[model samples]
Target: MNILQAKNEIKNTVQAYLSKNSFGEYEIESKNQRPLLLIGPPGIGKTQIMEQISKECQIGLVSYTITHHTRQSAVGLPFIQEKEFQGKTYSITEYTMSEIIASVYSKMEETGLKEGILFIDEINCVSETLAPTMLQFLQNKTFGNQKVPAGWIIVAAGNPSEYNKSVRDFDVVTMDRIRYIHVETDYYVWKEYAISKHIHPMILSYLELKPNNFYTVSTSVDGMEFVTARGWEDLSYLLYSYEKMLLEISQDTIYEYLHHEDIAEDVFAYYLVYKKYQDDYGIDDILNGNVSSSIYARLFNADFDERVSVVNLVMDGLLRQVNIYSFEKHCTDLWFGFLKNYRNHMDVSYVDHVKEFIALYHDKLQAELLSDAQKHEYEFVLEQIQKVNVDASLDSKSRFDCSTKPFFKQKENMESIESDLKLQIENAFEFMESAFKNGQEMTIFVTNLIMSAEMALYLSSHTIGIYEKYKQVLLIGSQKARLLDELAH
Candidate 1:
């Protein structure tokens, strides 16, 4: 089972104890407390579970790392000779009183709990020198000459001895007194919690990376170590910029962080399988070539259904290994190229489907062009005005009054004409695919221009002959050319 499932089991087990109707036959005023043991992997949140239970039960949690305490810390130093008490002849036992009570009072205020919880993290990591003292405390719930506060409950967590070579074996005497709950990693449950919090999308995306497949390098002189869940979290933030790294990071950055080169090697190894396929045949050939004799000859030799299944499995696995964001960008660029080609030679039905997307893009392009044309016309008029103003030879006042107003008006009219002609030309281009509906190759643009009256006058009579092959879609001739000329002016 995963860490979350293990945690829930522990919580449920403790809740049963808490829910016990009778507290050792003592009246409601008195009770007996049962302590607990949490056993789990290093990063699997054993201590976190105890804290959660304390909060849910409305009890304060005080934690100490047993591994950090030594014989010196547990046993007080003797006082200086002269400073030692004379009348009472007290020993360090009197001073140990102050230290023990200090640990108790804080629990009283936080939980308002008649009894609170004492959380011992990494209990199994305690040094051999301090192990006897820990056993004494566990056996009697007392340290030094004094007992732990009456209302306090003891809960200890430790990584399994199997996890590390340094982990010392726990004596059966210490093990028998408390319950043991084993915890494992559970990314699925963590994902649910992360989603509920509405975690940042970018962070959530990294978290969603396949848990078993990712890692970073270690800085050991001998070699690299594997990354843990905690290491992944730290490296994710560092990799957010998505820039490729050059040299190595400093020791200070990764000294305490875990890294696993094996996982990284595995990921690279997975990638090479795809590369091997490419070396044998081109990517396009693999994608579009005959399957039976090509790269997938073995799978192609199978039944059609089995071959399809194998193809799907390989594709899905390869796709999952890819950096999705980059793959999506590549697909979008390819689709856009297809769109441009489709605009040139597709049939009417396909063109109509393509038009929906183009309609929005077309409006944007037209608006941009119209804005540029107006700016250019305005600049030209300004240049003309400047020329008239600077020329000492010209009549400046007449030049100012010389009907540039008509030119400006013509430009405005041309702007409107340009918009109209652009719409017609775009429409003609858009409609050319109509001839393809019946699978014909006639050039509709030639016919439309030939029939256009405005276009006919601009064209020599010889030019009309060029339209003989496309008489099916004739336009009204000069009408088209006049419209174009107006827009051009």
Candidate 2:
């Protein structure tokens, strides 16, 4: 149901066919070899799975998009040239895609290659002009204008018809030629594989937190998307590298997909779900539950509006998965009792995906009680929730279309009084005293008075006068003369 299982299924099917006999020309291979058509919403890992299969099978992979190549490139005529020098002539042939096809055949003859897989991505986008040429290749294993080499397998991928708005519907003729696989979001399966691969801790956390939201847009279809194994892998790396910033980026990414500004509703819904489950069944009880009659009733209720509640429930369950192992039974029991007593009426079935997820959580209470792996996963989930919060906050902040009152308004009287006081103080000490110039020392008496007043105006106004008077007194004393004698001298 998830990406990994789909990949194994595809590879196993193809490898089986290749083992039986060598498929002929690329066109013939399309006609004879196994051709798989992966159909999924954008971001689901269709093309990547094929690439992986190619590596695992040890076969060469030639990948191209239908949008990138034209009928001219697919089947047009090419140029040939000859050069004559010193009575000897050398000839060289230049062919178009048609001629290239012939060369591949020639090489296949010489090398006896069994076949290489041809991956055509975005096949739904093949232009009108190229369709017939491609049809020719698909039908006869040969270009309209030339022959194709043997030993080639064909695999084409595109967005699913329902989700993709742009792809021209494939006619019965084209549909008949290939086997189809539909990829959907499988959170638990992906989490397991991602963890096994030692994928980035952050990525694991995000998936565990909100499995439905993590996905990529498919390249071919406008508005079409697919979740891929690669995306999860990339997310793991991103979380590991940019731990704190990961949440912000994730929110922006998810925001684009959801196409909505108010994600808090979804987040709140999830929190409620987590609380309900944490209270109803012990974390262990929920994880170990097989198919409970009550659980099934909660999951597939016909009367209630499912869409409004399902996502929140699923998200909460994932959050709980990473955080629960660290919880002590007594604590869990106490919490459950509290929930049952306080909120016995609340529905918690939103987060009951048992066998799929192991226990994990962010709270130290949960981490301390859980296993090492559970704690790590729980922390990652917490990080993801934080990312969602950040994204929501930033997006909401940016929308400042709503009016807000200014904070800390300046009082007119206070402002004017402060301004006047500052000006008066500045004016009182506009000129510096000579004694206070850079490094000049003050008279002991002046220093004592200045230190006491702690007022620049008082000090500045009297500083020079006091210094002058002290100097005159000192001079009169040094010369041993009265004031009148000094003046006469």
Candidate 3:
């Protein structure tokens, strides 16, 4: 399975475990539950998926790299204690709480969450001294003499023996005690994730053209030449920051992240081309519905690569507009809801408290209350409350306009922004239709848009008032269907 499939599987497994057992409840005799062992290549998002699962389940997570621990730290240190056995007192050995176990308890206390996942990475790459303890920990769910807390699930991950020299294969007896999942690299599965994460389009376009270069690990004269999903994501952050600073991306910079020489050179060369496209294509003008005849002529005469770049450029611009509008609507709704609740339930008591404070400090604070800044601050809150209540029954766009009035400073300016976004979406739809009519292949472009729209839909469903505002414009039926077909494949 690919990483995405593995992520879903892990999520389902965690949900099932939580369903069968309530928080802080565990039975030692139960045979239905077992720990998960994720075996995969290095840097293939094994740890990243666990974090995502923790967030999705709304549970706490405690992660540790077992290779970094010793037997003493992992299973705790031994201490001497007095015990009475057979009417004679004797000094016996007992172990303190394992650092790993202590961290789980601390996280639960800090988060106030009884149930969570305790993830140990590099489980198969532990030192020889710690190997026996790891086996006992997995099979018995205990460190030294202390068992894992009841509500926490144990998940361990490791790179396969083929990928890491230190990896040790589990014996049959140990294998029988846990569930295992093997994950492989799939470019298409990760492309959807990259689009949703807003990975640099330069990397996305380069990968689309040379999919084979997306992931590779081979021994070379330079020791090892490799590229992984983790590399791309980390590089994307640096590239984004560099672009913001208007700095020139040097060959050294590219090679620092993309370790493979050939792949790094290819990406750097294509990045130059991508920069050229950005310079030639006026995305802002297109968004404003100001595309000139020269631009259209260029599009008609351009090759497949240029056409793809143009489509990506347009799609990027459109998505940004939609994101901005959706974010504004979400914020406006939240503010309106808060103001309404305060007015209905808390305003009277709040005012009474203020009055009491003034009465108690009339002489000392009367002049302070009369100050211009304090008067303005008090009036501002009341004015905002009034404005929100007045616009509560209006449409989303109208409510947004009212909400942003203080910030935008002009109704016409806000309306103009709203109008511009609508125009951009319409223009994007028309561009996509024209591309299809002209027999231009836009599979990658369409797929990327669909993935972004799906992410937006997910967010909208999770949030209030965003779906009604963005669904029609962002996730139109035709685009949604195309994306579904892609996923089905």
Each prediction's number of clashing residue pairs: 23, 37, 0
Tell me the TM-score of model 3.
0.80
Q: Report lDDT per candidate.
A: 0.45, 0.45, 0.72
lDDT of 2 by residue, 1-489 (tens): 567777887787667656654353233333465466776665555766776676567554556676777666667666777888899998866555564365455544443344556666777757777777665555555565565444466666777666555576666786676677666766544554554445543343334445555544444434434445565566456544554564433455533434433442353354344445445533333323332456445544422223223322322232333223222222333333332432332232212211112232322332123435545544443332222211223333332211111101212333443344333322222211221222111122122122221122332443444344544543423333232322321
Q: Where does model 2 exceed 4 Å of error?
A: 20-31, 77-95, 98-114, 143-148, 215-233, 243-489
| TM-score between candidate 1 and the true structure | 0.43
Score every model by TM-score: 0.43, 0.42, 0.80
Worst 10 residues of 1 by lDDT: 435-444
User: Which segments of candidate 3 are over 4 A away from where they belong?
Assistant: 20-31, 347-419, 435-440, 453-489
By summed lDDT, which 10 consecutive residues of candidate 2 come out lowest? 401-410
Cα RMSD of all models vs. native, in order, equals 26.2, 34.3, 9.2
Q: What is the lDDT of candidate 1?
A: 0.45
RMSD of 1: 26.2
For candidate 2, the lDDT comes to 0.45
In model 1, which runs have C-alpha deviations exceeding 4 angstroms?
13-34, 75-95, 98-101, 196-209, 214-224, 234-258, 262-489
